[model samples]
Target: MLIGYARVSTLEQNEDLQVDALKAAGCDRWYVDHASGAKASRPQLDKMFELLREGDVLVVWKLDRLGRSVQNLIELINRLHKMGVGFKSLTEQMDTTTPGGTLVFNVYASMAQFERDLIRERTNAGLRAARERGRVGGRPSKLTHDDEVMIRQLYESRTVTVRQIADRFSVSRGTIYRAIEAGGVAQTEN
Candidate 1:
C-alpha cells in the first residue's frame, strides 16, 4: 500500500501540487498538513504514521515535504525502515526498497550530518570571537561599582526605602533586594 504525505509550509500555500503528484503515483490514502507556521502541529502526519503497517510504503512528492530539517528527515526514515516499511520520494526518484536507493539515502543522511557539523563549528567560532572581544552574553548590571558602594551606604543608613533606592537607580525593588543580598547586607522591611 502506498500512503502519500502532502504538506504546504503555510495556510496561504495550497497542497494541490503535492496532492496531484501523490494521486498520480497511485497513493491509496493521503495525509495532508497545512502546517501554516512553525508552532502549528501536524495531526495528519502523526495519524499517517500510526496507520502505516509492515508492508506499507510512505510516499512524498519531494523529500522536504516530509521534514523541515535533515535530522528530522533521517530520524523519520530510520523509524519507517525499522518498522519494515519503505519510503519513496517522487521528485528525487528515491526508493528505499532498492540497493541503489539505500545508497542515495545514506548519502543524504551524510550530507545532513555534514551540514550540522558546519553549523556547530561556525557557532563555536563565533562564541570564541565574542569572548576575545570581551563581549559577554548576559544582561548588563543595573548598578556600577560606584552605585554598589552608594547602595550599601544608603541602605545601611536606613534613611531611605528599598523602593526609594530602586526608583533612584531606575530598577525594580527586586534588583535592590538582590544587591543587598549579594553584598551580605542585613535585609529589613523598608
Candidate 2:
C-alpha cells in the first residue's frame, strides 16, 4: 500500500499539484496538512503515521513537503525503515525500497552529518577566539564587588538570615551563598 502525505505552508497555498502527483503514483490513501514544515505539530501527518503499516510505503510529492531539513528527512526515513516500511518522494525520485535509492539516501545523511560537524567546529573556534580577546560569554553578574563584600559581612555577623540578605540584594539565596563563598576565597588569597 502506498500511503501519501502532502503539505502546504499556508492555507492560501493549494495542494492540488501534490494531490495529483500522489494519485498518479497510485497512492491507496492520502493525508494533507496546511502547516509549515518547520512546525513540530501537524495533525494530518500524525494521522498518517497512525495509518501506516509494516508493508506500507509512505509517498510524498516532494522531500521538502515531508521534513523541514535534511536531518529531519533522514530521521523520518530512518524511522520508516525501522518499522519495516518504505519511503518514496515523487520530485526527488527517491525510493528507499531499492538498493540505489538507499545508497543515495545514505549519501544525503552523510552530507547532513558533515555539515553539522563543520558548524560545531566553527562555533567552538569562534568561542576560543573570543576568549583569547578576554571576552566571556553568558549573562553578566547581577551583584557588584561591594555588594558581595557586604553580603559576606552580613552573613558572618549572623544578624540577618540568608533569605533577608537575598531580599536586600534583590537576588536569590543561591546567589547570596555564592557571593559569600567568593568573598571568603578573596580574603584567603589576600
As a TM-score, model 1 comes out at: 0.71
- Weakest 10 consecutive residues of candidate 1 by summed lDDT: 34-43
- Candidate 1 regions exceeding 4 Å error are 37-40, 139-190
Clashes of each: 0, 0
lDDT, candidate 2, 1-190, per-residue tens: 9999999999999999999999999998999999999987799998888778899999999999999998888989998999889999989889999999999889989999999999999999999999999999978999998898888888877788888989998999888878988777332211
* lDDT agreement of model 1 with the native: 0.90
| Residue pairs of candidate 2 with colliding backbone atoms | none
Candidate 1 lDDT score at position 25: 96
Please provide TM-scores, in order, for all candidate models, with all chains considered together.
0.71, 0.78
